[model samples]
Target: MLKIKHFFLVIFVLIFINCSKDEPVDSQETKPLVSAIDIGNSELPYIKIKTISSVLNEPKIAGEMEIYINQKRVLNSTIGIEYRGSTSYRISDKKSFGIETRDASGKGKDVSILGFPAEEDWILTGDVFQAPNTIFDRTLMYHYLGYELFRNMGNYSSRSKFVEVELNGVYIGIYVLMEKLKRGPDRINIESLIAADTDAAKITGGYILKIDKTSGSDVLGTHPLSYYDTNWDDDCRYTEFNSFRSNYDINRNRIAFPAYGAPYHSNKYLETYFVYDYPKAETINAAQKAYIKNYVNDFETALLTDNFSTNTRTYTNYIDRKSFIDFFIINELAGNIDGYRLSTYMHKARGGKLKMGPIWDLNIGYGTGGRVPVNDWIINYNNYVTNDAWMVPFWWKRLMEDPQFRSELKSRWTELRTNTLSTPKVLELTTNTSNYLTNNNAIIRNYTKWTGINYNYNNSVTELKTYLTNRLAWMDSKIASF
Candidate 1:
């Protein structure tokens, strides 16, 4: 009887020990233990993951990560979880894993895949814009948003991606890996083809020749004129020939046209491209001058013919008219400032064919800063008072000196303001954009902290009205002089 009882006790003790060994260890030990066990296993790579989700309790295990090993799904075993906020799993016998995080609402976030030798999967090339001596990870968020905005606007910009991994148990925003583009030929060079005059044949031949020369080549073409060329005005001449000649120096190329918030004159870099290879020989004689005058007239006429509907003809000449009208409509509908200057370069480049392009550099417009406080004020001052306004009266007085042009301009402005104010699509897109109230609040908070202005709606309206009225009065006097 004593021997049977001892045998039963020993069997019970062995079973209890086996059960304890099979049970999962505490959460704290799971991470290190799994990591240690998986080390040099040479079978499957272990992955440490931190997930952000709208649902799911802290340290919860994801039922099925739906992992793929080298694009093949891992079907046999379950993944383990650790830490309240992050999870870790030993993915033994797998080359890659595709991870998808799904919320309680049944929406699946995009799947991210990881494999052995992670760095081999991601590659970056070119002259990445980086601040020296700083880790690329430190400024990822800002650079990402900045580059994204610039690219979305259709400007020549760069590309970026992110890379990160964990060591122990900490979260980090890692390096922003970037690939650089070799500089391409300037758009100005292409524009020169328009002057060659042999209809489709000459134009096609010019482009084909250029492509052949540049095929598989990294070098930029030489400009037609040097900086010291006699055709340039004293203020416009490039003092340093070598520095000003390069296509990569945007300041020297200044291809960016005049837009709201930017200075009125052509950028210095742009001036080089504009003046280089300009047909100074053709313009030196009276016949050439006459030809240029005719060319300018034809350019203006073409713009009017192409862009203006029969009803919109009167306002066609002023480059920013549509942009200004759009701005006023948006501001009135949203009760906030979000409009900015549509660039003058669009009209200048297309000979008035195209109307608008992507809005750039909105840091200031919409009751933001500068001496002007309102859209109406900008229109009134630019139309009437400024020496360099694009409106008819300003252009007529300075360049055209024709009374008919001024009258036509006034008529156009009156018609446009009335039409734009009545458009519903204009009203809806402006008013329905999200976060206006929040953005306005943020703006007010920032201004109050910095400038101590009480930036309420009434105050904004009052200030805008006062500035516009004053500028209008000033414009009336200037028009009278014209």
Candidate 2:
């Protein structure tokens, strides 16, 4: 009887061990899948986009996006995503995207994402992408730095947040989710100009103009505007319905293009065109167009013909001097290679002076060379790169020539260096941003998936800090002379 009981106890132990084999063990280590190595969960916000047709090649593609922050679902919304940027699009496999959040009926829906004010249009700008442009912003902090500095100066720069992105279940890498520059109460904060506002009081005021290459609608080939008056002004690339040319050359002389049309002559760099940005090329009416064109023309005329012999300056009547001063300081601070030429924006408000602000596109900035002296003013770009397609406008160069303007600029620069833009402060911002990315393992994950660029994340951050240090010092010495 004792032998039979012992045998039964052994059989019961065997049955218990067999049952435990099929159940999960809390102590056992589980290896992650192969894809999880590159695209695993992390501390940064994760934006996953699933397209309806699994394609995002065109300018606009229907999709649904879900954002997760620390593994918790924050937003799920329908969206229209599109490849954005002209040069950035052509240069990288990981393209920037313009996202418009939508409702079920496919109309733009306003919803707050990442705690920013509710707005439909947003942009996801990636860092360097897969381009071999080694000098490009691999540090991924230039845009944020430039915009933040401008905002600190009491200007309205685009608000941005860093986030990781995945499209169609494939991790694309880190992107700066930013607000698009547009006319809104929370954005540029300018009065709107619609098609019917053709009267004297309504038409005399608001307009947003940019000096940029013909893109977006030009690439889409859908602008309803007519060709510019080519009979007199032979720059046929411009259309009377959309743009107007500067009355003076870069040297502040009468306007004259050496040759006309697209693929313009080398001398075309001397000429500038103000493209209609707000009302758009298609919707801006004849009366409204004439009003803004004349206003800008008047401002230029007063600036160019000014004697500067007295305090009663006529140009001051047209422009807000403080805005121009701040804009100049911000661009000079960043060493923006494209500062006054490409991606430049100027706007006017109802019954207000023409203002230069809401600075855009600082990707290729922060000590990037543009054939100019490292310590020189970016507005003097033409003094170096003589034959570039886009040249710095005469506005800044002329403004610097004015004693009052120089005094104002010097005062502003001095105030900024004391606190907001001091070397230690700027370095702190850069270091903090880098630490956030590093602590979350985002830099490693981003570079792992978007390889071949050979980006040195740590070194890039170090170099950025060094550049800012030197740049701020140089600017300090130069602005002192002003």
Candidate 3:
């Protein structure tokens, strides 16, 4: 009886073990299969990614990801990616990401996935906030054209290419595979500044500054006073560039790199606008902070002086004038509400003048911001919306007040319009980009997912053409007089 009972127990254990063998294995450990696709002669490159994270967190986090270009495997590596943008990030499904390419260990990188001028970091922009892009602004060609105008005009602008990105096997819409603004061999092209060398000589040479949303960690400066400040200049009231605000206490221009906070001082507000970004907060020392602070103080001092334009020591001494003029044309033509405000970047090279561009974000520009049209002039914001959260630099407005600056601006504008920004060229860019997007099956999928069937593609393109035509003409007429 004991032998029989032992035999039954052994059989029961064998049965249990056999049952567990058929269970599905963990998906993470295994390589994922991508759906094979063959679309001949595509407009933009088709990109697909498979992320290892089953749990995708908010404000996207990095995971092991694979990249497929036109169904051919290109890269399999670890990367850091996060949903990026201000209002655009709110989209639940159609989200954009900031991609950081790295080696398998997530340190050190080897990038250049899509021949887009070879940069490690790229942006997968969904561009979905202005859903269905009414009046040509939503198709995203407007923003593309704006950047290309800047680049094609011989100024440094981020090179962008359109891509249909598939994330985790799901088709996300058209994304612009764009270079992230960083100090690099091909980008910004500034001398490398290091934290180990705390000497002011090395530290003051290269720094990137931005004027944007105030962060507690940011280096900031207070506005001198609003246009409506007590000593108001009702008629010739344009003299002040930096001012203290009434409704919002501060208009912050932050130090984006070598991101260190200022030391506590009696008048700390005097030097909060230049936050450290590159060496980062952890590595930066006190001497580096003081060096940047004094450098900025000198620049601001020159800006605020009575003879900013004509003084023997002038504003031109502090900046690269061409960069400023080029940047102004892009913003003014596009009517960027966020111009000189958010995502705006400036860098000072080791012993180099403070430079204006390599123009950044313009998704809401080209009359897309909804606050103003592409035809609207931003040099003076309709003389009504002066209290905007982000105001144009007094430097740009003040420089316009100078005859020399105005002449330079008009000359530059003419040169751009005649070449890259000409009506015909602008139309061609929009049409080509639009055609490429329309040719992709993902275009329909993206729009259906984001805006449904009623969305009008033709009308949007037509509206864009109209905006560009009107914008070019208006700017030409006005700029010539300047």
Candidate 4:
């Protein structure tokens, strides 16, 4: 009986030993592992926050980190095993992040410092406000207002899109973007009006601009129309108008015109052109004289024979006579105030015909700048002499000196002024626009400041009204002459 009891005790002891071996050791009182670090904070306008992680170099017994923003749980990740040393996370926000982390394991481990995500380092102060009224008035009048007038005047301008939105809880308006324009390689043709003067050698490359639909960025490039000074000498004027009849060649890269007019403004003005392979010097040379006559003739022949409808029609002989008559009338009405420089004329390459382009920049008319007024018939008498000197080529000057040009001008002026001179209608439009400005003062002010205009509502309105009336009158006179 004693032996049997001893055996049973031995068996029990062995079982106990096996059980003890199977159990895991205390792992040296291991600290909890930290896998990731998270950061949470207040939401920002135009910004988004994503994820955060850590980088670990030295081996740790145990690690754990808890991230929070405004006391909110951002992330809880294993520290020691998952990420041995350090890691990074991406954040999406207009502003930088403010985060805090806690070491829960308490294993005497040094906590890693958190860094902001790339491209989100700045903190928005939320202090930006709308610009003043004066600034907006100027910007609206010069850019937006002028654009509207141009459209009304039958000009080909980029379509505009305007909108208002809230940024950071602040209402902002007058945001604009335009459509992209595809510019082809520049080529010399009678159809092009803008860069016709550029030499074929200089017209080398082309570009496709993803233009902003609302802002008219494509039409103005970097410089706004307001950048031009009111003074003729200080203003950058388009001198090619007198010489190039066409503004742009939709199909090819080229600009062409008929004659060179007087230098009314600075030559360093903005002129639209297609991408072309040519040197700037050569282009300028082509613009100054009849250097591309043969090219023009060839372009005209192509236009006349081409299947394109606009080009075919413009190149016809009848259109040429009509264009000549139109030009003569506009010249006489404005006292020959550089019509060729202000407007564009387009011609088709195949038929060598002509058509009227958009009318631009007539704010200084009616002798406003100590020049001759529009109604002064006395200015009409000099039409023949001016035409002979400017419009007619040196050889054709004496031979084409006909009095019929003057008569045509006078007759057109009478018809246009009588039909279009509706000052009250224009004022009504201005009043409605002014109301819109009032409602969206914040956006208007912001844009005004961006354009560098002083904030003064009344003054801006008065100035705009005056300019509008003057410009409208000028347009009426031109149309009548047509």
Off by over 4 Å in 3: 1-43, 54-64, 91-93, 130-137, 214-275, 306-313, 373-375
Q: Where does candidate 1 clash, by residue pair?
A: 44-93, 59-84, 68-98, 251-269, 252-269, 253-269, 253-270, 254-269, 254-270, 396-401
TM per candidate comes to 0.27, 0.86, 0.75, 0.35
Q: Which candidate do you rate higher for lDDT, 1 or 3?
A: 3
Clash totals, every prediction: 10, 0, 24, 87
Off by over 4 Å in 1: 1-343, 347-400, 421-435, 438-482
If the candidates were sorted by their lDDT against the true structure, best first, what order would they fall in? Answer: 2, 3, 4, 1
- Candidates sorted on TM-score, descending: 2, 3, 4, 1
Model 1 scores a C-alpha lDDT of 0.28
After superposing all C-alphas onto the true structure, candidate 2 shows an RMSD in angstroms of 12.1
Give the worst 10-residue stretch by lDDT in candidate 2: 223-232
Q: Rate the local accuracy (lDDT) of all candidates.
A: 0.28, 0.77, 0.60, 0.31
Q: What CA root-mean-square deviation does each model show from the true structure?
A: 20.7, 12.1, 10.6, 22.6
What is the TM-score (0 to 1) of candidate 1? 0.27
User: Per-residue CA lDDT of candidate 2, range 168-256, in tens?
Assistant: 86888789999998889999888889998888888866788888765542223232222211221222255566688887888889875
Local accuracy of candidate 4 as per-residue lDDT tens digits, 258-358 = 22223442211222221111222224344323433333445344443545423233233423444444444333432334344323233333233333332
- Model 4: residues >4 Å from true position, as ranges? 1-139, 142-157, 161-292, 295-339, 342-352, 359-421, 451-454, 468-482
- The candidate 4 region of ten consecutive residues with least summed lDDT is 84-93
* Top of the candidates by lDDT: 2
Pitting candidate 1 against candidate 2, the one with the higher lDDT is: 2
